[model samples]
Target: MRVHLGSDHAGLDLKNHLVAWLSEHGYEPVDHGPFVYDALDDYPVFCLRAAEGVAKARAAGGDDLGVVIGGSGNGEQMAANKVEGIRCALVWSEDTAKLAREHNDAQMVSVGGRMHSLEDMTRFVELFLAEPFSGDERHVRRIGQLDHYDRTRELPPLPESAIGLGPDA
Candidate 1:
């Protein structure tokens, strides 16, 4: 797998570690980075590139993934999701990392550099890289809804039970 990585100054260390780790583990790691640390660096600048790399690779029929890192990972995740066809999940635990891929079929994951130990974050990334999407009917349906909304900007209909329960009703 080709894993694209990006990070702000806060996550530079962890991002560098993962780059080496990913290569050592036989995955092709692409560093879309701020080669040198700058305290004022922006997460979106790098995160968006990483997300775009994954989106472009996948659109070309490749199984590529991405990782974006920042102090809290919240902004990085938001930035990544702004790219078309990119599903980026903010993963804080091994379970969430695995679920990001299995349930959401996410092509990218965001990690918080200041939220956990280096070892814990590393484990989460490892789990994320190893998991596969479940491809279950329900999961696929939900993903389809999201994809539909992404392409059409049209909201899915409310459930029958809630159809007449709006504030206007």
Candidate 2:
């Protein structure tokens, strides 16, 4: 798989480890910068570009994935999702990482620099890389709606099937 990685100064160390690990596991890891870290360097610049790389690769051929890391990972995911066609999911656990790929077709994952041990990170990455998106019709429809929103800047219309049908509705 073609995997892109992006990290801020806070995540530089872990990112380095992940790149090596990915190579050993046969993934092509593409670095998106913070190559030489500065403490004040922002996560958005690298994260956005990483998402772009994956998006570009997917457009060129098959799907490509991206990983973005920062102190908390929240801003990194936010930044990655700003790019159109990038479904970025912030995952703190192995389960969430797997689910992000399986259920959301998430092309990008965000990890926190300070949240987990190296072992945990490895587990999360392994599951994320292994899981495949379910691609059920509902999931496909939902992602399509999101993609439409991204392209048209339009609010989603309520589905007739969804109206007044929830537990509280």
**Top model number, lDDT:** 1
Model 2 per-residue lDDT tens digits across residues 1-169 = 9889999998898889989999999999999988987999999889889999999999999668989998888999999999888999999987899999888999999999899988887788889999999999989888988999889989687678888877636
TM-scores of all candidate predictions against the true structure: 0.97, 0.92
Q: Write the per-residue lDDT of candidate 1 for residues 1-169, one digit (tens) a residue.
A: 9999999999999999999999999999999996898999988999999999999999999999999999999999999999999999999999999999999999999999999999999999999999999999999999999999999999887878887798735
- Report lDDT (Cα) of residue 127, candidate 2: 90
lDDT of 2: 0.90
Cand. 1 TM to true fold: 0.97
Shift of residue 33 alpha carbon in model 1, Å: 0.1
The CA lDDT at 54 in model 2 is 93
